[model samples]
Target: MRIIIERSNLLRSLGHIQRVVERRNTIPILSNVLLKTEEGAGLRLKATDLDLEITETAPAEIEMAGATTVPAHLLYDIVRKLPDGAEVKLGLNEGGTQMTVSAGRSNFRLQCLPEADFPDITTGTFSHSFTMKAQALARLVERTQFAISTEETRYYLNGIYFHALEVDGASRLRAVATDGHRLARAEADAPAGVEGMPGIIVPRKAVGELQKLLGEAGEDGDVAVELSDSKIRFTLGTVVMTSKLIDGTFPDYQRVIPQNNDKALTLDRSTFSAAVDRVSTISSERGRAVKLAISDSQLVLTVNSPESGTATEELAVGYDSDAIEIGFNAKYLLDITGQLSGEDTVFMLADPGSPTLIKDGGDEGTLYVLMPMRV
Candidate 1:
């Protein structure tokens, strides 16, 4: 298409859209970013990788109205390296088989693909659409994304599950991710208008993409999230991202959460995390098990390995329950601790073999579940 756009704006949109374009493609058109010039306003840019698509419209001066596709990544790199604030002019050359890009003192030409080759997603019934503050979405993703499973056998667990639930008569949105050994759950107030929306699994790759956009969404702006049965869409001002949902049922995570753990221990989060890191130095290479011995008001973290001797560290806690010994993966414990936003953490224990429930202070909406290891 023939259009003139600011170099900075074009690069910003390209940076986001080109990431969805695959480096190696069986279809030639899939490797290009479709650019269409509007009659009087701006230009539209789109790129996809079969599963996900990103479209952005930016202000541009239109010459002749037309559309063409150029190499997605190559075009992005060229514009990114150019001087800032440069005005870029693009136009269809000779027989419309190629488009020329001119900016500053540099000029380049790229072969064009027919705009008809690009695929379109007819967004089906949007069962839910809502607006949420950017900060809330960021917090929801930060707390639970670390625990997403990477195992291939349990394909369903490879992504974060976004679902709505009622807790204490209040509507809340929860994000849960687990790899079987450790689980993380984060909750936030559910945005209005999505009370009955179906839960969906957001693949890790898509989650990463969304996070990048949300980061740039500005703290004051709200993001509009919409979803149908098969696809999810995120609209932030001038940018829009759409992706296919993972077709899998997430497990009933509520059942896995421990219910009756009465032994409560409160410890300084940083100290405990450091102790776990120190003692785990002697843990075995495979399991990386670290033992926790708690009695009266003292907790001792220890680890033993056949090749390496043993290590132990003591920390003062606020527990009055019967003395208990529990073992857990050092890495898992560290992850749970990393979620703590404050200094003190609360851990509930039933016995040496049961799951431990960890929470920061009295916050019940955010919790961590960790299975004990047999040391």
Candidate 2:
């Protein structure tokens, strides 16, 4: 393949595609990106890690229509370092074993893998398809992705759960994630053509990449999503991403969401977050418990560590119930509060051992449940 593409265009496509390539690959071809000339269309770039694949096309002046594979990260780095506005010329050697990249005075030769060696993720016929504003999808990921579990044993909890639900006669789409310690749930009005979709678990890696691509498309742009029980695909503007879904079943997250916690505490989200942050400074470990003492209208946060000194902070909150003391992970508290896009946050507590329900005043469609820590 021989093509002349603007450095900016080539770099942009490379930046998007190279991230899917793993830093270490057991298969030689898996470390390379497949580059093919599209005649009048443009130059197509593709990279994959077996489970996930991303493809993008950039406008280029095609000299000879052909295909080749080259190291993804190396190509991205080379194009990224090229001077702005420079034109990048890519040419395959006659033997088809090497690719050369040239821009102005810079030149580099990259080892090439046979295009035939590249693997493709077979995307069978999709069972359901839908389209929604890119920003909306991005927001859904932003809301719950932080709660995805990192444990490998619970493979099902490593991704966000997405499904179609009928709520109060209105169809809605929901995204949920939980790490056993905390759960985040966000819902939006379901877009057309998403009915009868099976609940799918989107792996953490795919969720992160999709978030970046959708955000780049901006709020005005629309994203096309297609899925089956085993795989999912996203098409945003010129980019296409296909990923294998986690085959394991997600646990029933709804049962974990608190339904009837009556003790309520309404406090400014910023104030509470700040107090938790300051008190947690004394915690020697990230998961250390921060004790919360609530009485009348005052809330006191205290953290004690044998290695460090005790830290305490007090704030006046709106609470009306028997005074209750609870313990929670300071880091978990900060994460939940940071995600609450509201002036005030409501915490419905049942007791010291049970989970607490958190709601945002600014967003009614989102809720979070956090398991308490033993102080």
- For this target, which candidate reaches the highest lDDT against the unseen true structure? 2
Output the TM-score of candidate 1. Answer: 0.93
For 196-300, candidate 1 gives per-residue lDDT tens digits of: 989999988888888888898788889999999989998999888888888999999989889999999999999999889988887777969998999999999
Q: What is the lDDT of residue 106 in candidate 2?
A: 95
lDDT of candidate 2 at residue 90, scale 0 to 100:
94
Pairs of residues clashing in candidate 1: none
Query: Counting only residues 3 or more apart in sequence or on different chains, how many pairs clash (N, Cα, C under 3 Å) in candidate 1?
Result: 0
Q: Any idea what lDDT model 1 has?
A: 0.89
Q: List the global CA lDDT of all models.
A: 0.89, 0.92
Runs of candidate 2 exceeding 4 Å displacement: none
In terms of TM-score, the best-performing candidate is: 2
Model 2: per-residue Cα lDDT over 1-375, one tens digit each: 788999999989999999999999889899999999886789999999989999999999998999999999999988888899999999999999999999999999999999999998955888899999988888789999999999999999999999999999999999999999999999888999989999999999999999889879975999999998789999998899999999988999889998899999999999899889989987987557899999899999999898887999899999989999999998888888988998999999999999999999998989999999989
